[model samples]
Target: MKILVTDPEGYVGSLVVACFTQQGHEVISVSQANAGAALSLIQLAVTDLQNFDAVIHTGEICGTQALHPQIAGNLHYRDAMHLANLAKAAGVSRFIYLSSCSVYGAGEEEYVTEESPVRPQTPSATCKAAIESDLLTIASAEFSPTILRPAIAFGASPRIRFDVVLNNMAGLAWTANKINIPGKGLSWCPVVHVLDICQIINCILQAPRPLVHQQIFNVGDTNHNYQLIEIAAMVAEVFQVENFSFGHHGFGDRGLFMTFDKIHQFFPDFQCGWNPRQGAEQLLNFFTLTDSIQSHFTLTRSPYHRSENHLFHTVSIA
Candidate 1:
């Protein structure tokens, strides 16, 4: 199957490109290759601020870990949306948007299904939600548009986000010895291995159009959604650090268990085969590199800083 993957050098995009390319899919990188190739663009144009005072103030006021929303990369973000139309123009079989579960809002509730409403509080999520709405509209019987709401993704990529649950806990365990769980560690945090995400996209590419042609799948089975504490314990086991400990932690990016039963209604064997322990172990192996933003665990380069005023660098997946 032929696939056009945007941000091919990005964390999720790179992982997807590696996975599909390994699987023999004809792949194209719209972000890296040609600016004219952007399917749909995003607006992350705000440059990273240089003032340390501003970072501290924003952190204090906004309570976000990153310096700010990824505004510098907005144009590319916007172009990715056009990717769907480009895919159709290219006669591509499927257009997959690497969306996030953040659109579903933080933490779990009685009901968290695909049919649930999306409240995108943060800029990143807001852009994702908006683009998703645009994508669903251009889709139809002929053009297969699938939006995958993946749980917190962690795996080998250029931009590995240590901010996510499992990776964060693993980073803590690897460095601080105790995994920190905010607020009783009871809230559910749905997770999927980075490679598993690639597998889901590959499935969409391989499956008949009806299974995913214009459908949205919550890219994991019910077994994948786990509580924070449970996830931390698994990471502890991965490090062979018996009795690893953490307390209730707090963050604006809350998470919850998600029901992937709908996707399972089609593929029963769709479970993410990688156990949390194993996943944690894979990440923990890079303990020394965890602290530096250049850590080997990271999948995407931090666009927040640069050696020059130059803001954007392109990677072509032609």
Candidate 2:
């Protein structure tokens, strides 16, 4: 199988490219550098798109920084729509969109399923929900669009992100010997390992067309939901840090507890191999092996901050 992956240098995108290439699939990738101009070229290069069997779009303004409406609209919604159109134009049948469980957004439900109403709170989540809706609307007999709403992704990647909750706590525990829980640490969040997300993409690509076509799947283990305080404790245990504290202020009420039953029932072969404990352990090992110091842990370089033309190569891993 041949695949075209966007934002191959991104946290999940990098892993997705490596996973597919390792599985003997031919993978062609495009970075998010100069998205507008690059996508304009891509439009002209429609013939090139025909060479791929599927498109895995992970190229978007991710993380909390995507709260900016203009940035989110252009990078997340516009770019995605353009890519989908190009893919469809090139006769690409399978378009797997990397949406977010954040689209469920601070719901009152105990467990939001794929069917649950999307109440996007942030601009980032709103763009995601909008993209999902538009992509579904464009679905056809020839074009099958599958949406994977992954939970807050953790675990290490070649393009590691420390902005996320679990990873941030792990870094703090390792460097400062303390994990700080903001606002009483009461908000709930679902997390999945970076590797698990890659695996889920592979499973979807391999599954029968009927099973995934126009389907929305929340990607995370049902058991992996944890309160912010619980996550802090888990990180503390893994890093062997004794000091962890909570803030006196109130954290935002936004929390999402997602059910993975739809994905599990649809693709029985899919399994979540890493939980918070294992993920923390992996991060600890990664930090130790890399000799990561306080500086490395403290510097938060989000993709949104990168130069528009900044490009990265696919990380080759064994």
Candidate 3:
């Protein structure tokens, strides 16, 4: 199938691009340097949208640094809605949007389902929830829009991210010879491997229109959920960081415990191949092979940081 994947150079986007290409799908990538100009450019790019069967949109400004609601809301929420319309205008049948489970927020609830109420507290998550709501409105018999709210994703990517929970812990463990939990380590955190996320997307792409149309699937296994301390223990085992401790006051115990039964029931063949231990091992191997082990796992060139820097440099040059 012919596919259009946005932000192909991003952490998640790069993985989706590689996975789709390896699966023999014809994938076209799109990136508008100016987030503010995305809507206009996408609307004008009629020739670029020709003959694509589906679109997987992974483009958006997101990070710890993207804390401002106004800026993030405009870039992710507004731009996303516009992109959805662009997909429909381009005659694309299937639109797959990558939403985050972070929209569920840091609730005391024991479990979060796709049906759970979203009380997004952060600007990033608020934007994600808003985008999901708007995207559902655009779904139709002809335009089958599917939203996958993936858990905190980990695993090596062409454009790897150490900002996520597990990866961050792994980085600290490898570098600092210790893993520290800022708060009590009981806060629940769910995780999914990057490859598993690709598999979920592939399923959505292949599934019948009736099955996935307007569907929201929390994309991870129930078993994959782990407490922050549990995660620290796993990282400690991998990096052999004996100095693992908890009970710092600054960080509170805000957790996300999501259930994946919806996606599991829909695609029975789907399975998360990488557990925390296995994923940690893969990361360790990656660090060793890339000579990052000696470099103290310091990434001199982070993809997200570089993208922002490049945009600034380009704008300055212009």
Candidate 4:
């Protein structure tokens, strides 16, 4: 199959490109500068998309603060709509949109399913919800659009990030030898390995058209749901750190418990390959191997890091 993948240089995008290429599929990778520029480029490059089997959109601006002015000012909604239009104009058969579970927002609800009413509180989630709704309307017999709402992803990427919950705790344990547990660590959260999400994307693309057409799948396993303190304990164990201190930081107290039954029913073969223990160990090994434990702390300490101090901090909000 021939595939057109956007944001190939990004963490998940790069993994998607590599995964498809390894499976003997032709892949066209492109970078979307912004909504307006991306639309113009797509028009100019329309002829190149002929006979393409699918388009995987994985481009969006992300940050630690969703309500931050800069994040709210991003063109993700426009960009995603334009990408869907591009696929339609180019006669592409499939469109895969990588969305986030944050669309459910924060509430006292114990569990969130795909059928849960989306209450997007932040501009980022609002944009994602808008894109998902628009793309579903574009789905037709010939054009299959699949929306994937993945849980907070962890594990190593080509573009490694330590701003996420498990990774951040592990990094702190390995670097500063101290783990900061924000809040009471009792809030529920769902996490998935980056590679597992990539595999789920690939499966959705390869599944029977009728099975996934216009379907929304929450990606991750139910067994992977965890709390903040549980993640911290796993990190400490993985790093073999006996002495760890915890403090209450005002950030990352909110949590969303996402359900994954839809994804499991759709792709029974898909399994979460890594748990918190494995993911924490992976981060610890990567940091130790690169001798970048200190680097992780340094970069994540200030304005350079864009990841929110939570489980669902970094991801493509397509």
Candidate 5:
């Protein structure tokens, strides 16, 4: 398999590149600069420059995504739209669009299926949903465009983001000695480990024609959904923070739990190796090690202090 990936420097993109290479697939990781091996010289977006065995557009635009729509979310809308067009024109064999579970909207409702009426309330999620319809049109007899909507994705990345639930818990527990909760602490958050995300990407790529062609599968494990407090408690236990405290920020909020029955049914052997504990623990360890070094005398005098703060603090979007 010759895989061409855009945004190859990103967390998930890098992982996908690694997955393809480790599996003995010839991989060409393209950024905005260099196109792939066979791409010759064309340009608009990275995808526009390459034709390969497959194209997985995992490029991202990040900011806080919530109920209300935002202008920043439109960034992804424009970027992904161009990306999809470029991939299609490049004559890629398979195209996979990395979407978020938030397309299902946020709530505590259990087992939201693929057909369960997409309710994209937030700006970012809304953009994804809008472009997805276009992607589905490309899923006809000629091309197979697979859409994978994953819940909160966690793992090690060149860009480690702690704003996500599990990683945030680990950050605060290690730094502030607390895991903040705003409401009943029972709102469900569906989570998927970064590795499982990689495994499923391979599964989708290698799958037989009729099975995955032009399909949308919600990727997750049986433990996909978890109550907020339960996840926090587990993270605390993982880090041995037996007495971590909680503070509420918002109220009367609910979240939707996702259904993975469809993907599970298709890839029966797909196993999620990392749970909330593993993810939290991994985050905690990273934070601890980094913090330990930063707290030292010589290191404290360096430029890394503010860099560390940038990692933990949510900068107000200007």
Candidate 6:
């Protein structure tokens, strides 16, 4: 299959490109700059969009940039809609949108499902929810948009990110010999490996059109829902760190816990390949092989670092 993937240089997007290419699929990558360009420029830049079998949009403003409504609106919502419209215009049948599970914000329910009402708290989540709604509205017999709301992605990638929860804690534990848990570490979050996210996309692209058309699937293992403290402890154990502390106050973002039953029900063969411990171990190995130090763990050193603080943030790439 010929696939056009946006933000192929990003963390998840890079992995998606690699995964599809390895699977013998022809993958054309578009950077964020080109994707967000003027419509006329985009049309000229990416010619023959109709020839592609699918357009997987993984480009957006994430992390702190997503905190601002204007930035998130222009990049996440407006620009994304532009690309989707272009793909639709070009007769692209399968449009896979990478959304976040953070859309189910601040829920008290034990497990939020696809049917659960979206209560987006942050601008990022709000934009994601809005985009999902608009994409579904634009769905037609010729165009099928499948939304995958993946949990906070962790694990290793060619474009590694130390800003996420598991990665940050692992880096801290390795370099500083301590894992710092912001707030009381009580907030719940679901996490999935980067590789698993790519796998889920592959499954959706391979599945029958009717099975995924206009569907929103929460992408992660149902059993992977965990508390911040639990994640800290896991990192501490994996890195053999003796010191880990929690803050006195809570982070403003609401926790998200989701059920993956809908995805499994539709694609029974799919399963998350990596758990938190395994992801941590993979990071540990990465840090070891690279001889990563304290400076390497800092935000200033890595372009992939998104958060000012290394603790877990509600915002993440799918």
TM-score for each predicted model, relative to the true structure: 0.73, 0.86, 0.86, 0.84, 0.83, 0.86
In candidate 1, clashing pairs total: 45
Q: Rank the candidates by lDDT, best first.
A: 6, 2, 3, 4, 5, 1
CA lDDT for candidate 4: 0.75
Summarize candidate 5's per-residue lDDT along 139-158 as a digit string, tens digits.
65656788898877775665
How far residue 115's Cα lies from its native spot in candidate 1, in Å, is: 1.1
**TM-score of decoy 5:** 0.83
The residue-by-residue lDDT of candidate 3 on 95-191, one tens digit each, is 8989888788775577889888998876777878888888899887778888888888887888777767677666666555666564778777889
TM-score leader:
6
lDDT of 1 by residue, 43-92 (tens): 21222111111000000111121355665225324555544555555455
In model 3, which range of ten residues has the least summed lDDT? 309-318
* Cα distance off (Å), candidate 1, residue 118: 1.3
Error of 2 at 46 (Å): 1.5
- Which pairs clash (backbone N, Cα, C closer than 3 Å) in model 3? none
lDDT of each: 0.58, 0.78, 0.75, 0.75, 0.69, 0.79
Lowest summed lDDT window (length 10), candidate 6: 36-45
Error of 2 at 76 (Å): 2.6
Say which candidate scores most in lDDT. 6
* Per-model C-alpha RMSD: 11.0, 6.8, 6.5, 5.2, 4.5, 4.5
Instruction: Give candidate 6 regions above 4 Å deviation.
Output: 34-47, 63-68, 252-254, 292-318
Deviation from native of the Cα of residue 282 in model 6, angstroms:
0.2
Q: What would the per-residue lDDT of candidate 6 be over residues 68-117, giving only the tens digit for each residue?
A: 77675656677678888888888889999998887887766877899999
Residue range 107-179, candidate 4, lDDT tens digits: 4477989999998876777878888998999888888899989887788887656656776776667655667
Assess the local accuracy of residue 265 in candidate 5 as a C-alpha lDDT between 0 and 100: 89
> 153-175 in candidate 2: lDDT tens per residue?
89989888776778877766765
* Deviation (Å) of 157 in candidate 2: 0.5
**Number of clashes recorded per candidate:** 45, 1, 0, 1, 3, 0
